[model samples]
Target: MTRMSKSESRHPVRKFFLFALIAGAVVAVRNAVSDKGGSYDPNEANER
Candidate 1:
């Protein structure tokens, strides 16, 4: 028979979801930064 511990068995799913979330955030940020015609002008807010 095989043996499994509670902590060891629970780690993979949690790790996979965490990795997936981080990967998704990275892709989203890359897409946003790569877009054109979008600019952030802090002075406009200050003028108001």
Candidate 2:
């Protein structure tokens, strides 16, 4: 068997974190875009 460099061994781990970050951003954007206007209102709070 052959030995691998430190950078080479960490490459896959770096790639996985990058992919996870991108996926999280995509899900957040989709959730915001698909919202159906159920937002909160400061003025409405006074009525309660």
Candidate 3:
């Protein structure tokens, strides 16, 4: 069996933090979109 190096051992922690950051960003964007009457369409020209 191969042994894990010191750097490799921190992969899970790094992934967890990365996932948390992404999740927080998504939540923030979702909240902003929802609070804006939920009518923000990216493909509509009249949205401006």
Q: Report the number of the highest-lDDT candidate.
A: 3
List where candidate 1 sits over 4 angstroms from the true fold. Answer: 1-9, 37-48
Model 2 has an lDDT value of 0.66
Top-scoring candidate (TM-score): 3
Q: Write the per-residue lDDT of candidate 3 for residues 1-48, one digit (tens) a residue.
A: 145665666578887889899999998997788567566555452544
| Predicted candidate 2 versus true structure: per-residue lDDT over 1-48, tens digit per residue | 135666757678887899899999988876665453333443444554
- Model 1 lDDT tens row, 1-48: 134566656678877888899999987875575453234444544554
TM-score of each: 0.53, 0.53, 0.59
TM-score of 1: 0.53
Give the candidates in order of lDDT, highest first: 3, 2, 1
Q: What is residue 11's positional error in candidate 2, in angstroms?
A: 3.2
Per-candidate count of clashing residue pairs (backbone under 3 Å):
0, 0, 0
Better of 1 and 3 by lDDT: 3
TM-score of 3: 0.59
Error of 2 at 46 (Å): 31
Cα-based lDDT at residue 24, candidate 3: 100
Better of 2 and 3 by lDDT: 3
